[model samples]
Target: MAGQAEIPADVVALCDYERHAAERMPAPLRAYVDGAGADGLTAQANLAAWQAIRLQGRVLADLRGADTGLRLLGLDLPHPLILAPVAFHGLAHAEAEHATALGAAATGSLMVVSTQSGLPLEDIAARAQGPLWFQLYMQPERGDTLSLVRRAEAAGCRALVVSVDAPVNGLRNMEQRAGFRLPEGIRAVNLDGMRPPQIRSEPGRAATFLGLMDAAPRWEDIAWLKSQTRLPLLLKGIMSAHDAERAVAVGVDGVIVSNHGGRALDTLPATAEALPVVARQVAGRIPVLCDGGIRRGTDALKALALGASAVLVGRPQIHALAVGGAAGVAHMLTILRAELEVAMALTGRRDLAGIDETVLWGS
Candidate 1:
């Protein structure tokens, strides 16, 4: 709170956002947001992912009633922004997932509540004023996984965003360096009593990642999982066309081309670079959503022009929530929507459908 005198409480850009957040959080939590992740290359790459493409400006177009609204997977949004799932919200604010649910609803945006959410899924759902999706992290036990999915379904979640990227949390150097760990009181409340999976390690040898993944769900689990629920299933963390093809072949309703925001496997290509190719593979058979290093309306527009049905924004919203809770999150979306509108008008794009590769300079 020492810097509160200098940094403004409200943020319209990154500088103020970072300043206020630093004023409030302990050093370890800041590192959780800004550091770690495979020498930080993939995370750093995400920041610059949209730099290469430039939008083409058109002279004039019929701009009457210009809008940024979009429809995806049976949900209508006032704009193309979707809130990506980020966990451990209690670290940022006491309201945790409950505040985020309210914030998403306030902005008419959708939020994918994480399995690691600080509040119970039901509590968060009670606060949501708009559509909600639940992100799943396939519990070690199939029964536990099914139980959470059933809860989300009963709570009115529109979809299940199954995150496949992080079979385990990334090897976060900064988290280790800062000695960061979840506070004792804060935990994944939805999974309060579930059994963690068992792993067999060799004598004096650490259990390997491949070993843990082996204990985890595999590609073949899709069919059985689908049979257990009626909600639309979206496989997140997909980056390759081959995986997209496989997902479609097996009846996936959607795929998000994400590199886990560079928090999962390091050295993966930025979501910006991977999205176009993955979108091409889906060929509109299923909606393609993407997220990574997105900060402004221009970033979202660049992604849409590259063939994403919509874009996901995670880190920035968290920053806003850290600064001012639900209202702050709404303001961030408001600024983004305004920016998107200006970008659309300047580029002579009338609507979401009008965005295409042609808008990009080298496409």
Candidate 2:
């Protein structure tokens, strides 16, 4: 609420939240949140790519009764945006994922719980009032992955999102330079007590965590994963039209066009650039959601027009939680919702359905 008036008048206030968060968080945490692959070209491009798409406004339409609600994969969302899966929220705040889940659900938005979440999935689920989706990072073995899926199902998660882009961890030079690592006593709760795949690195090294990730999930593995969970399966980190088509063919419930927030690959195309092509490839057979570089309501509007059922916010919400806990996250979502509503009204698009390619001009 501190910057409410400014959000409608200027987009810079939305970004201010990130700056405030950086000041509030410790150096290591800030580094992890701000860092991207290699030179951060893809990270910078993610934000720039969205800015390049201009909106074409329609005038003189009756916008008296505008609505932002959308039905994504059978769930009715008040807006076409959801909180992206970010691991170890506890690193940001003491309340961690619970605070975020509560804030998102309170705003009628969805929350995607990461496999590496600091809090237990059930605890986060217990606080949610809106839809909850579990993000899966398949363990080194099939049994471990299946077990995690079953636990998520028991925790009342409505859908399963399998992140497939991180086959191998990306090079994060910032974390290394800052000498940052997951703090002691913050082990991923779901993975607690399990002997995670060992990182074959020098002892007491930052890269040790990378080896713990089993980044290999082949097409057959996807099939096996599908058979393991009854909940609808969504494939995240999809950037290619070919992979989008493959996801549809493999019977994925939906596909999220993402570049892993440019955290996985240094030179990958921004999510915005990849969305339209993937949307075309899917051709409405399935929903195509996108995430990465969505900082403002207009950025989200651009994504919707280009071909996304909904957009997901990663760093923005995390920064919010880091700065002001539940209140900050709530305020951030509230600001974004208000901006989206105003943008829709001003553009003469009264509803989510009214947003389409007609409103966007690509550079």
lDDT of 1 by residue, 109-178 (tens): 8899999898889988876778999999898788899999999999999999999887877888888899
TM-score for candidate 2, residues paired by index: 0.91
Q: Name model 2 segments beyond 4 Å from true.
A: 1-12, 198-215
TM match of model 1 to true structure = 0.95
Query: Residue 56 deviation, candidate 2, in Å?
Result: 0.7
lDDT of 2 by residue, 1-363 (tens): 232112222324569788777777889888898898888889999999998878877789898778999887778778887899999998887888988887787788899999989988888887777789999988877788888899889988889999998877788888889988889989789987655665676766775355654436788788888877779899999898889989998888999998998888899998889999999999999888999999889888888888898999999988888777776777789888888887787777889998888776542
How far is 146's C-alpha from truth in model 2 (Å)? 0.9
Give each model's whole-structure lDDT: 0.83, 0.84
Candidate 1 lDDT (Cα, whole model)?
0.83
Which 10 consecutive positions of candidate 1 have the poorest summed lDDT?
A: 1-10
TM-score of each: 0.95, 0.91
